[model samples]
Target: MTTTQSSISSTSPTPTVPSGSGRVANIVLDSFTEAGRHVRIIPRNIEVLIFATIQPVMFVLLFSFVFGGSIQVPGYPDYDQYLMPGIFAQTVVFGSVFTSVGLAEDLSKGLIDRLRSLPIVQSSVLIGRTLSDLVRNIITFIAMLAVAFVLGFRFEGSLTSAAAATALLLLFSYGLSWVQALIGLSVGSVEAANSAGFLWMFPMTFVSSAFIDTRNLQYAWLRTVADVNPFTQVTNAARALYNGTDPGDAVMWSLVWSIGLVVVFAAIATRKFKTSSE
Candidate 1:
């Protein structure tokens, strides 16, 4: 019996993993798992799905029919074409509020605490939340585009240019999601996060070239501010690309702004998350 026990012990196999590689794998797996949880929730909430689909559709219709006649672009015959990119930018930017509200709700409900207690990677929650929000924004973008198409919005640019424009808008929204995540982590409640999320966006969008040409503004100061606004750069880039016009330096500036936002906000959010966990 002693010989048998010794033989069994000696033959036992031990598992080994490279710590760095293992951690990376865990983070990837955990993030995707968390993202799947959020994605599943969308289908279960019928009202949320309905509202998400309807709101952008409403925006496209209302803006195209009600305001199209009155609003004029210097070189365009169809205002709908001019209007679609603005609506696209607006809708996607507003979609980031969901991230803030969602994270705030999770924090308030003690879900963050629960997650902290788990063995998963610490950054997975933020990564997953941002990714899920990006997916939601994509859906919203598609719905809005379809509605815009029915309203006579067409892409005058090559399909590749239109696709690139869409990608830029999504990248901008992704960066904004990180910003919202930081806001969500900072705020005490979902209500505060919701209010805070839209507060900045209103001024930014209105003051930019999203709805109109910056040159058309009555005040020189307003035009100057709009000209320098990051939102203005993004909208102008999208408009130029969609209309097959020379995108010029707008695209480069928009890319830089988006990348900068992602880096700064992501670092802040990750630090806050670690602090909260402790």
Candidate 2:
């Protein structure tokens, strides 16, 4: 019995996972799994749902009922139809900001360091943050859909197309989260990270083809910019899914953007994290 107690007491504490090959995959999976377990503990889940649902719902009604009749798209039947998909893309895409803010908060509170010491997978920090946010965004998407239905926005596409649209949106959101995660790691300050994450969305969402068609713009340059914006691709993809319009090249563009962001930002964020650790 004494020898057994000594053996138990001699056991070493778990070591923090070391960064190396396949570290990222392990980190991301672990973080994602841990985040999933704590979903109910996060107040942000409710906040995200409310924000995602209410804002889009209001925009849908405001545009469709108030101004929809006044504005018309040449190839579209009505304004609400054009506006609904845009709102989905705009609202969900903006969710990337939360990824950074959450990471910043974790770092600021030293929760990241604690996790780092827990024998976790090396890339777990970045992966966890990205995957967790992806799950949250999915919830937000569902809530937004509920709101959309209540406001009379209907999907005209096959269920398969709609499911494909959701998958694409989630993929794009995950890729964007990697960039946001890097921003959080670099800033290492919750307030600054939050501001940086959100500030870009203003120009990205408002100045594009989200609410108004580019053709209606008085400025040729503004029209040109909106026409080429990556965001327009996402909205167009969503529109295709909603109205049964052929996804065309917009889906391709969306996929390119998502994959590109993941590669670029994951590399940057991982580098920053390693540098910070060293």
Candidate 3:
């Protein structure tokens, strides 16, 4: 019994995370490994992936076909160009919901417990999840771009500017994924996460410049809200880049907002994750 007690004490503690440079290396490697695990299995779950891509495509078609005829904004003769960037922003922002739902699902399946049992950085699991979801968002974005081109959407900007716009959207979405991570860790079930995660999405997206110019909004308060929304900064910046127009403060503000969201929410989510694991 004494020998057994001594042996147990001599063994490393559960989830024996490393220290100093070793810990940093472990986090980087473990995060990529977890991301790979999620990404690799994506092929087997083709239907979920297909539907996720399809929703944005449908939105593009519906807005371009039904609403394109009547919606006219000053300076934009073809509404498709003005419309495409908003759709891209809205879709990717909505895509962050996947991170929350996925995490909640993993928790329900005891995957979180399994991850905790291993000698890896606990926070790496969250990082990996957000990274994998970002991958899926990239795939979805590419598909939407192809469809947008078919709908006569043209980027008047240089290819480099267009690429910059795409990067900005992805960066914003990546930041939102961290916010979802916190929600997922806080929620008890996948259903709860889904419900809670999307509750703010519609207001956040539609109230902004996603569909039309916030300048056209008649209500001053509503316009103010849309103008101040972080999503508005992202959408406006993307729109300006795609149209080869100056983004003014929008681009800088978008980067600032995205980076801020990532920094703030990643810290909160990491703390919540550690607490939940304990």
lDDT of 3 by residue, 1-278 (tens): 33444565466666644554777888999999999999998878999889988999999989989999998888789888888999999999989999999999999999999999887888999999999999999989998899898888888999999999999999999999999999998899999999999999999999999889889999999999999999999999999999999999999999999999999999999999998745
Candidate 3, residue 159: the lDDT equals 94
For candidate 2, the 10 contiguous residues with the lowest summed lDDT are 1-10
* Residues 155-271, model 2: lDDT tens digits: 889888988887877887788789898888878588999899988887877777778877888999888888888787777787888788898998999899989999998888888
Best by TM-score: 3
Output the number of the lDDT-best candidate.
3
Candidate 3 has its poorest 10 consecutive residues by lDDT at 1-10
In the range 74-181, model 1's lDDT, one tens digit per residue, is 877888878889889988899999899999999999898898877788899999999999988898788778877877788899999999999999999899999999
All-Cα superposition RMSD per candidate: 6.1, 4.1, 5.1
Model 1 whole-model lDDT (C-alpha atoms): 0.88
- Cα lDDT computed for each candidate against the true fold: 0.88, 0.78, 0.92
